[model samples]
Target: MDDATRIELEAATFRRLVAHLRERTDVQNIDLMNLAGFCRNCLSKWYRAAAEERGLGLDDATAREIIYGMPYAEWKDRYQREASAEQQAAFVEAIRKPDA
Candidate 1:
């Protein structure tokens, strides 16, 4: 595929992933971190950084709003849950694993 086509496909995939995450309200950020070592917050931060790299003045809240499909605080209030001990332990262990 041409570079432009590849970029378009990647962008579309990213949008789909974000949309899926937005719909998966039962999935918490901590759970994502424990399983994948990243979450919506990480994606938001990446979005913010990308914006800043392109000279846009995107802030964290707005970035998170894009990823979450709503304001972060509101989403947290509505769906965020306290991480369980097991989840926290797994997250720690996951973080400690050396990348191969």
Candidate 2:
């Protein structure tokens, strides 16, 4: 409940989420974006932003590698799929939703 404990718990949760996403390669980013309003790339961006806030000098590629558990281009080549029309439409709708 103290600040340090809260930070540790949040960091552990983030690591677990990243690990889960790494294990679930079949879950495409587009599907995540369509369904959840965010994706691995969003997480990568957030990670990079956090690093910048801490003066850690993390770049996009490094942030993406951390999030993807590998080089992003390699992950994309191996696991990423083209979004279906339905998926794209859903993503657009999700983005436009007031609460999203």
Candidate 3:
């Protein structure tokens, strides 16, 4: 496929992933970090960085809102829960090992 087609497909996939994450409110960021070593926050940071690369000024809060489909504080108040001991331990271990 051409570059434009590839870019379009990737953008569509990203949108779908963000939509899925928004729908799955029960899935906490810590859980995602423990499992995949990245979460919505990471995505937001990446989005912000990309915006900067293109001469845009996308702040953390705005990038997070884009990824969360709502304000970060509101999402946390509504859906975030305290991580369990096991979850915390897993996160630590996951971080110690490099991503595959």
Top candidate, metric TM-score = 3
- For lDDT, candidate 1 versus 2, the one ahead is 1
lDDT by residue for model 3 (1-100), tens = 9999999999999999999999999999999998887999999999999999999999999999999999999999999999999999998888888757
lDDT of 2 by residue, 55-83 (tens): 89999999999999999999999998888
lDDT per residue (tens digit) for residues 20-68 in model 1: 9999999999999888889999999999999999999999999999999
Give all candidates' CA lDDT scores: 0.95, 0.93, 0.96
Between prediction 2 and prediction 3, the one with superior TM-score is 3
Candidate that would win on lDDT: 3
- Ten contiguous residues minimizing lDDT sum, candidate 1: 29-38
Can you give the TM-score per candidate against the true fold?
0.95, 0.94, 0.97
Colliding residue pairs in candidate 3: none
Predicted candidate 3, C-alpha RMSD: 0.9
Those runs of model 1 whose alpha carbons end farther than 4 Å from true positions after fitting are: none
List of clashing residue pairs for candidate 2: none
